[model samples]
Target chain A: MSESQQHHQSPGSPPASGLGLALFWVYVLLYIGFMGLVLVRPDLLSLRPFFGVNLAIVYGMGLIAAAFVLAVAYMVLRSGR
Target chain B: MLHETSIAAVTIFATFVLGVIGLSFFLGRKGQSASGYYAAHGQIHWFVNGIAFAGDYLSAASFLGICGMIAFSGYDGFLYSIGFLAGWVVALFVIAEPIKALGKFTFADALDSRFNSRGIKLSVAISTLVVSVFYLIPQMVGAGSLIKPLLGLPHEAGVILVGVTVTLIVVTAGMVSTTWVQFIKGSLLVFFCGVLTVLILGRGLAVNAGREGSENLTPQIRTVRPDGTVLVDGQPQSRDHDLRPVGTIIRLPERFAGQESTGPLGPLAYLATLEDSTIVTWATKKHADSEGVHTTYTPVERPGTELLKPGGFFKGLASGNLPDRLDFVSLMLALFCGTASLPHILIRYYTVKDAAAARKSTVVGIAVIGVFYVLTLYLGLGAMTSGALDPTDTNMAAPLLAKTFNETLFAIISAIAFTTVLGTVSGLIMAGSGAVAHDLVENVCGVRMTDHEKIRCGKLAAVGLGMVAMVLGILFRNFNVSFLVGWAFNIAASANLPALVMLLFWPRTTRQGIVAAVTVGMLASLTWILLSADTFEKVYGLSRDLALTPFSQPALITIPLGFLTLVVVSLLTPAPASLRR
Candidate 1:
């Protein structure tokens, strides 16, 4: 990639590495899946209703967790890059 | 009646306005070119732009509306905070890079990148104008609203004040001034809100034992039958009102279940009569009657003991009921998704250099915005039981809560609120100006204007948009300004999000598809709202039940329809190879 193009795509750019791409696509799928689950069957996700933890909460938390996990994994495996 | 016209408030407001104009003149030299005027030469620092984002994003809705909503509704209001921040995820992860790479002046540039189609330009421009105008109303109305309570001026005066000041700001230096103004407002708002939150925490919760000077007497209520005669139970009762008044105050204490609650703790609570408070009544009294009856109300007081425990609105929200929870979740979703897709917000990306800066700025913006939202929760809860709520106006809850502490804090916050209008409206007018100059005058009309001419035309458009916004500010004086903003978000998320997302990700997304989606999304949402029951009742003076849509909000349906239209239309169209990656 040219220097200008590289600058344009840095920071919050879509995943480019094979592993990164795989992880990104997985995260996307998880997001979609959990969202669908929330919309379709909110009760199946969790039993904690009193504390405001319903399907959307579960999915929201799940996505955050997944993102955290991916960030950690990327740091561990792709340090040299 | 209102303490808005104090010398301190007027002086602070005047100083802020003069400062904004001075800044514009200082920045005017740099904004001489179309590029500089409209896009700030794409050289604004990422961190600065990020804070500017907060400034631009946190309008009256964030400072006043959300705080008010939270003060009244508890955890439900915090839902708006989460939803608004969540929308940035889309901005960071999905939009920033592509929008930076593809667009030049306006969102239309990004949508029409693949094909140089006039149809796309015209359609997107119209959508931009529609969203900008809808968005403008709230900010202008907020300006007027704040002025009434802050400067002790008429609502019209506030609207005019903001309109003139912001037009000068925009016309003088365009985006450069708008960005800086927003940056300053954004920083001040966050800082002040932080101080208020700390104050609330330090003071802890205390029962504002009702007013001291008033002669203490039990409130009186009388039940009236369908006839003019007042009745209690089955018999006619000699009293002023029909219903029996409940005199005792309800108390809610702040509760710390886990480790998180560390603030000063005393009695804290929300007090409201069940039926009287919950039911929003419309007068059955006839028009043109010799003597007109005004709105009457019973007061609900909070006991000194409940100030330390968390119940009331929070308890109801945490009760996990479906309707309450859904209302909370849906509102949050709107706030979260709404920020990224807002037309005024999208234009800010153009004012920064490169996609990288845009993304980085969004991260920083989110951090600032997120922290402010956290502060809103504290501010709202603190105000809930501060015993300063105006039964007529909930928006004053937070500022009034500050007043309970000290007058200086009130003056500063109220002035900041006024500048908040200037900052957000300047940004809105800039977006509208871009739509008019770049999309309509240049591309759609085929006018070959020089960069100099374009900047001139943009300033003119800014003035025009500002005037229109001022009129709307006065007209929509009575409507819930925050609720109106929600409709704007729905329209923006529906109209702009699908087209922008599809254009970036799907190479097959033709110009025709882009135009169709935006036009449909904008029109569908706009028309739906116009014909909806809320508008029919509020705007058109008709029965709300006679309206078309089952509910007032259109996000759940129209947003998906927009995405669907984009996908389906894109599938049928072919793209040129060069335009495609």
Candidate 2:
């Protein structure tokens, strides 16, 4: 097999990038914050901050939205390199 | 609840199943080579592979289980949706590119790439098999749940049908057919669910929506006799005799009081309206009697505000007890970490051409999955107030909710759901077969084989796994499908995640450490689950108080134990020369 084709088939891992790791920890903190609120102060989640929906719903939906946004960010930032 | 066999449902379901199998046969010719059979020759387009990821990941658990959970319990079910989607972030940001770059076919290929150790191959392969089988249980149970309502067949028949069909799909074309099947299933599921959600928003909220003449809102009683005969409300159960359909709004918001309906609310308005309504949810109690085992479904009126919070089904959030609270945290932790650790999910990275495709596909998967999960909140709440829930089977909430709208929608949704089972079960069987054929036989046992021989071995493995899945599906029929899936996430997260993450980020990871982590993680979580209170009450049919473990979900404890084992073992052992800086 040609070297390029072989590399495609069995490519080695490149060094870990800073941007991806940073994006990952950013999500980790968001997820942990949601879990922490649910455990410690669930009453706060019950409060309807906006849209007449509870903070729990808002935060949960936000986590899903944040994941997609951060993922797109990583894809765009990494492709630039 | 009783279901009459519907000709339209049966026909749509048969067409779906046959169409999937025919597609497999058409794709079978291309999967003759081992590489093609295992990874679709790594040539699938990024967009197609992305949708295919949704097909593979959104199992019966995500569709039927999560929807039913939300319908029956309220906000606690959506908690699963958030946790499940969050795991994809880990997949995309951390595991996606690296896994694609390192592995050719199985997750073991990625783990063993740097070490090339038989120990790593053997342990990781075993972990893959355990996780796959655990995950397969819920899909098969979901199949049984769908078939009972759609075709009016028994649960075991549904399990067998799915097992046989999924085995055929895997043995016929392997990943090539599996990918296409998933693409079709994923696209149909998201599109139809989108349609269903719009219908829900358009219909809006109603006071006692389908309970027009049902003034007798009494709790219904069902009994199963030792002689295998069944009775509902002291009458023999039949097509004409069954528990009354339940779940509806008892009262609307104070602003809309005395109003029959709040016409066509928007998404936010729907939640805001439901938050103020008084919803009637069911609670069940069982007791053994001289006649048989009688179960009663009693109606409980809960405020929309309470149901919209975190405690309805979890009970821990409501009780605020330490053990219960810890169990909830542990389950959420497992759901967060488990996505990247699943064997079927990991192997999908190998089906793409390169690391970049893997990364792109994961992003695509998140978008599709995220949209579906958002819709789940609506679909579930819609069902909760649709006045069409079967008290005996929460898993049938979504399909039955479709029935409340129209029989044709019910037929189409149930058919798509059956295909949902087919798509996910095939992917799981593919992962299991790869573990058995490539990882265990070829690498661990050192059995050399030609390409044709390898393909044959994988087909055999697929058949074996299908049979195992069928048996487990039958044995665990009574448990909620989503609850069973939680056990799978716990095992996969505890057993696979620690080793995988450390191997990529930590330089001191040794070959021995990988083996130790996988083995210890797998065993610890499995042992914890077997001793848990949920298992005691559900599996062994014993009292929960007699259980050995303090809490049910084990990921909170076992996941950290996995990382600790890896770190401690790697420090004790010498690092490979290449890993040294």
Candidate 3:
């Protein structure tokens, strides 16, 4: 219980490197943007429909693409740093 | 289904199991101490811990159950994929670092951090054990399902096998072996599923018009009347009748409905469906036996395509209007929120070294999990058209689809399915053991036990929980593996997530508030599930239509209730003055 009191890095702290913060924000914005796209255009979200159930393929793919974009952003940001 | 177990499959299965046992023994050494046994001394490498996250998280539910659901249900099935993946986002951004920075052993440590209330420990520990056991049942049931088909053994033997192996894993090394085993299983699952998906895309979708229906076309029907006596055809069918056969699917002469590619669907084509055509779906009911249960069928015919995709199981959920959409949304919400909140999954974060590693590992876990989920669509669609669907047992759809491609592939997948059970069950046992030894015995009871005593107590607890899991697995042998998982996710999301999230983010969260929220949330949700019509008819042998809840899943009702309880209760009780520090 005593060990629990030690102040660790607050969960909201920037990553150790300055560039990690840039990359993190980039990812956050991209994801939020993708989610916005989904919200605005629900039609883009429905790929496979059987029995009126829209498969969230559009949503899943959008997320994956955003993930890749984030990865690339991290790499580029890190390289520049 | 009759293919003999080959040397390759046996070798792969045996090697994996033996390697797992060896890893257990190695990790099990330091685990002789209590901290080592329960939480791996809270010193695992971040990278290893991260992959183990993938391992521990991707249970039989992910691999067999979801894939089966997707293969049978079409787009609605993929909704689960998205929900589950979204949960990791919540975990990574919101929970990972905070959980690692604060807690040790059980989730109760983090919740009870401000006030060393015994009540918090007791309630959260009970919630942890209850959720862990609910989750463990499906893993054990899946093990039985996999083993019966894999080694030609009975369901009882499979359950016993998992129980024995998991108990040994827990009793011997605890979290150390559990983490490594999960790491291995997780890695192999992602890799192989990737390979299978590629193979599926390469093979492409073709109509096997030559296939003929079997003599009976018996359809393995279950008819549920107003009273829930499940009957096959006109007679009552016992769950022990696992030997039922389903109707054969013959593909009509048109192209595959959901394909974006000309040859076969690469990973991209599967996702590229909404660009052109609107997916059409309709539902029909078939009567089985003397019971009057209605089966929803998705007539998989695309608008212009002659080839029809037969959507089983959840086809009804897709076509219906607002109420149906709510059911879909509720299920997705449970999955998205549930992943971060599962007790078994959260404990794995402790197994890693520091907060940074936990975050990094979560990132890796998301990457790996995301890729695997994408592959599921390919696998499910492959099975749907491969003429290998068991309408009676959607859980077997993926493996049977693999068999349609190659017997050897089928063997490998089956063996992997068993390991899927192993990895998940081991993590669950680790969670349960920690709840008993770390939270209940040592923390609440204020036992002055040595490290050795702690480890010893945990081993005993593991044995007890494993036995309980074994019996439940055997008793509930006939339930669909995926359906049961919904219950697990609902309970975990309701009981645990609210408390964990509020404690981490809100400074005013009091010990009494946490305890009450957990107790009420857990009991209320469990009661709702049991009293619901789905449970009465499906689980307790009562009438589904006669039950109270419109739907079986409690996520829509219970998750919000849990959050509100925590908020309201915390507002009412001020934190203790000493606890402000």
Ten-residue region with minimum lDDT total, candidate 2 chain A: A2-11
The reply for model 2, stretches above 4 Å from the true place, is A1-15, B579-581
Stretches off by above 4 angstroms in model 3 are A1-6, A9-55, A64-81, B1-8, B209-265, B269-323, B578-581
lDDT of 1 by residue, B139-258 (tens): 887777777767777889989999999999999998888899999999999999988877776765332223333222333233333445543333444333233221221322234223
lDDT of 3 at B494: 87
> lDDT for each of the candidates?
0.68, 0.91, 0.70
TM-score of each: 0.80, 0.98, 0.83
Error of 2 at B172 (Å): 0.9
Q: Enumerate the candidates' DockQ scores in order.
A: 0.13, 0.53, 0.15
Backbone clash pairs for candidate 3 read: A51-B281, A51-B319, A53-B318, B28-B173, B223-B291, B223-B293, B224-B292, B224-B293, B233-B289, B300-B309
How would you encode candidate 3's per-residue C-alpha lDDT over A53-76 as one tens digit per residue? Answer: 233454455565555445445444
Error of 3 at B493 (Å): 1.5
Q: What pairs collide in candidate 2?
A: none
Quote the TM-score that chain A achieves in each candidate.
Answer: 0.60, 0.81, 0.42
What lDDT is reached at residue B121 by model 3? 92
Worst 10 residues of 3 chain B by lDDT: B303-312
